[model samples]
Target: MMTIGMIVMLIASVVMVLASFLSKKTTTDREKSSPFECGFDPMNSSRLPFSIRFFMIAIIFLIFDVEIALILPMVMTMKSSNLMIWTSTSLFFIFILLAGLYHEWNQGALNWSA
Candidate 1:
């Protein structure tokens, strides 16, 4: 096992040395660093302000998607689990999900228009 590990480490080091020597060297050029858009140089700033609403909506979607994934597994375990415990747990989870949704809705994160 020691011999095998040593051999693997030797091979990895050889590979790393070869990769470093064989890698392409980048030449510094002003035009190469500049952003190209349809054969024309960019007229405006590349870092433009984005809508916060879109980001909020995406986060909300991810939260709900994860909740759905959690809920699906709970459904599969329903047969083995106690009915009262399962019902209460599911209702609690659903209530939290609804509360989050309500909070986002009230915050105007769901609104598309400025």
Candidate 2:
């Protein structure tokens, strides 16, 4: 007997193959083929300059979000059981977090008035 994981994988693969075959006759035209821009033509040659600060903030957010996801489960486990585990995990997570915050502070990424 196939395991549940294997049965699910097989069903997923069959569905994907059927979807691909059904979509083969889709039309192509100048409007359909060209890059879509919300029905707007590409008129401008040079794009506007974007500040790296916004991108930096987005990257930093993603980093912290992932870090939180990884640590929250462990943190919760500590909270439910023992104070020693709680203190150790909290200190470990906070230490690296503070280090990252210090780096960002020094590099001026945290500055919004720039």
| Best candidate according to lDDT | 1
lDDT of 2 by residue, 14-106 (tens): 999999999886676765666666645655544668878887888889999998898778756864778886888788888998899789978
TM-score of each: 0.77, 0.60
Per-candidate Cα lDDT values, in order, are 0.89, 0.81
lDDT of 2: 0.81
Q: Which ten contiguous residues of candidate 1 have the minimum total lDDT? A: 39-48
In candidate 2, the residue pairs with backbone N, CA or C atoms under 3 Å apart (3 or more residues apart, or in different chains) clash, namely none
Can you write out model 1's per-residue Cα lDDT over 3-91, one digit (the tens) per residue? 99999999999999999988956777776767787754476667768989889988998988998999999999999999999999999
Best by TM-score: 1
For candidate 2, which ten residues in a row score worst on lDDT? Answer: 39-48
Enumerate residue pairs that collide in model 1: none
Q: Which stretches of candidate 1 lie over 4 Å from their true place?
A: 33-44, 112-114
